[model samples]
Target: EGDFVIMGTDGLFDNLGEDAIAARILQAYNMMRIDGKVARAVCSWASQALLNDAFNTSLSKTAITPFSIAASEELDLAYSGGKMDDISVLVGMVEHQVQA
Candidate 1:
């Protein structure tokens, strides 16, 4: 129930896997819960976290990324490490109003 709505470009997914992305958002979710704040309050922090992670991963020579794996098997090419590209990430939350 605390998960956020994440949207991004190919660069984001290319550098990071599902588990890496989930951990970042979950950290923000947990922090917001502890602070007793709305999910929206941590949106900025979560987005930044994803950006930093993706950027780091993209630059890591030893880090295996989704794009690398696909390029290796599907494309039958010799590819290693993360792929550098234009990454954009957005973190948001949905709020609902219950009837009285």
Candidate 2:
């Protein structure tokens, strides 16, 4: 199966759960397929979207704080209420095995 594998740091996981991540990735994948998108483009879009979504979610007042009170306090001065942490996202689309 040529499935897409998304790896990210705690910063991302704390803001977005597996289902949220998967849904976004799947939506991106479908859009790419429809537009005949290349792997690099897909990966780039997925990475950027993941990062943005996490950042935005962290900033939302309704969202539960992903960081500890101390951590949130430290970050609040910088991010102004957003969770602060290093966020790294890598998306790998596995190659499909083609039968001869």
Best by TM-score: 1
lDDT of 1: 0.88
Candidate 2 lDDT trough over 10 residues, lowest sum: 62-71
Predicted model with the maximum lDDT: 1
lDDT accuracy of residue 58 in candidate 1: 93
Model 1 over residues 1-100: C-alpha lDDT tens digits?
Answer: 5447999999899999999999988888888878876776689899999998999899988788998999899989878888889999999977676799
Worst 10 residues of 1 by lDDT: 32-41
| C-alpha lDDT score of every prediction, in listed order | 0.88, 0.77
RMSD of 1: 1.9
Tens-digit lDDT track of model 2 for 3-99: 8889999888877767778888997788788998887788889989999988887777556544434455776742323466778888878877689
| Candidate 1 wrongly placed segments (more than 4 Å) | 1-3, 98-100
Native-to-model Cα distance after best TM-score fit, residue 28 in candidate 2, in Å = 1.6
